[model samples]
Target chain A: MAIEKVEYWRWTESNWKNPDIPDWHGSLITAGVDIGSTSTQAVILADGVPYAYSNMRTGSNSPDSAISAINWAMKDTGLTLEDITYTIGTGYGRVNVPFSNKTVTEITCHAKGANYIYGPTVRTILDMGGQDCKAIHCDEKGTVTSFMMNDKCAAGTGRGMEVIANLLAVSVEDIGELSFKVDEEPAPVSSTCVIFAKSEATKLMRSGWTKEKVLAAYCHAMALRVVRLLERNGMELDFAITGGIAKNVGVTRRIENIMGIKALTPTMDTQIAGALGAALIAKELVEKKRAKEG
Target chain B: MIANYGYEDGSGHYYIKIDTSKCAECTAKGCISACPEKLFATELDDFDDEVVLIKEDARNTLQTNCARCKANGEKEPCRQACESDAISFSW
Candidate 1:
């Protein structure tokens, strides 16, 4: 009997709505949609306050992904499209959010979002998105001073880890905890390229290395790769990590260990940073418009 | 705003940062035609000012796409053609 294939790399999609905020009737409802390479997020804000959000895998097309993401965010929230006063689209497909009132770069959005999530003290932000990694320096107001991103290859990004997760047949959510099971830290993978690293990992596994040891090695390599980006961009104190990879203890712990700096623990879901920043921008635009009209 | 187009990776950084403020005053905009791959273009930026920028499709592939220019041992055509001194590169 043949067993069905299990796609362990796929993470569960999540949608959340704050129960405390009863209704958005009197508030200005603003929305933000981030269409990233591997995932999409929709965030809704009521009068510049956090509200509902959804995180889902991006489909082949972005417009559909944007719409579905928002729909999922509004599910059971008693919210409707008509309730939103404005929407800002951001990320890899910022231009393709069919209903966005405006578009902003992911770099700008992520910095602003981190400022809000981690508070005004946050100065450095490391965002490990699906296909890219960003190291950003921001001011107290969340304005970007300088930023660098690694998008040419998948070496240290979420996509790279996804490849490893599939190779190990381990659930993406469990990759972090499982990686720490090893008794001693293994040396990092020497190959800098994702494809080459995958092959190197396979070789190690074949040579009697356990899956956990390979994972530890890969995570160490990822941390080093991302640290190089931070060093290039200049890291400041009160550093924070965002995006999906921020949830992975394997990578985050390794990075903290190497840098000797503790990243801010997030109070909210880290994946929503871009969308939240977009929503924040939407609120600013609406305020500007209202002030101009008055 | 300075528009940085390109990415960094394990291999190294490859970027072309262009100052949009300077581009607004430029008339020739030679970077458009200077690149052998025609990687540069112009568009109304977020501030509604027409400025030069790298093509969206070429942003992520700058490493391989710009290899020939860097390997040729000549100043990059895009930066060399900029009369406004607005363009710079990270190799």
Candidate 2:
């Protein structure tokens, strides 16, 4: 029998303009660019409020990806690079953002982003990005108090999910919902390494395990792996999840079940957290500079 | 078994190298407990010998994770804890 192919997890790229943005004829136009491994994002702030933002796939060139994301964000807005008073670069390709005024680690940016997205009450953040995962503890203001990151392994990351998507001919976006259609939660795959897990999944397929069953196993394993990282960082209340994995209900629900805490629902795209945080930081830097100059 | 942890960006290259040749002789595995960030773990290598390895997630962010040790101008806890002198940082 021929296996059918489906592209469920391919989320559409979006550029958004906040309807409530105020007229800022003389306000500082700050921006943040997050050049991640798999996706790039740019967020623009009018003074300290979000104005516009874009999220897209990162290309082979980091500098080009940063510029492309920023241009897309500014496309609908009557803005240009010169209009941005300060720019902060963040994520894996952070240092490569040629036009940025400074670079901030993704950890700090994610904390700040979580604070803005979920409100200042959020104290814990779990950012599951393409190539890595971060568990962060922060103050009410989104200042990182402690953080732990897992970048070396792909097991609990978006990339790992993509690998499974290709293997099962399922859409990356669809894996989460499909994973839950099974009669019961299958045992998690034994390996924590993506490469090894792939082999284990193939073995399960040979044994007549259904695609949803295999996916359920993988999603459970991914959630469990991330929880280990979160436990190491120490769990705090008001937990929020950022990055692409936040949209995967299969993994997010599993994570909530394991942790016994529900994650705050984000009003905006979860992927924008890093860039939004960077933009907020840009605003702070520009204001500090102005105060010092005065 | 030389394992490297770090990434190369426009600014520069940052990595932490752990030589498993030296790690094979370690009986204390102090690096696993000494790293405040808990970036080390003991695992069985391909040859079926147990060795202390730096968690893969910790490799790319060594500069950021090891900042506290560097800022204090003190010997890195992981390096100091290693009796085999297997760990080194390249910033």
**In terms of TM-score, which candidate is strongest?**
1
lDDT of 2 by residue, A127-234 (tens): 999998888788988887655666666889998998888898888888889999999899999535899889999999999999999999999999998897777568
Determine which window of 10 residues in candidate 2 chain A has minimal summed lDDT: A3-12
**Deviation in Å, model 1, residue A128 alpha carbon:** 0.7
Per residue, candidate 2 scores C-alpha lDDT tens digits across B3-42 of: 5556433344466767776887788989988999998998
Interface RMSD of each: 2.8, 13.2
lDDT of 1 by residue, B48-78 (tens): 6688988979998888888888898988888
Calculate DockQ per candidate and list them: 0.39, 0.07
Q: What's the distance in Å from true for residue B81, model 2?
A: 10
lDDT of 1 by residue, A1-294 (tens): 999999988998999988988766656999999999999999999888888999999999999999999999998779888888999999999999998999988888998899999999999999999989988888998877667777778889899999999998889899899899999999999536899899999999999999999999998899999998788777799999999999999999989999999999899999999999999989988998999999
Q: Is the docking of candidate 1 incorrect, acceptable, medium or high quality?
A: acceptable
- What C-alpha lDDT, on a 0 to 100 scale, does residue A64 get in candidate 1? 99
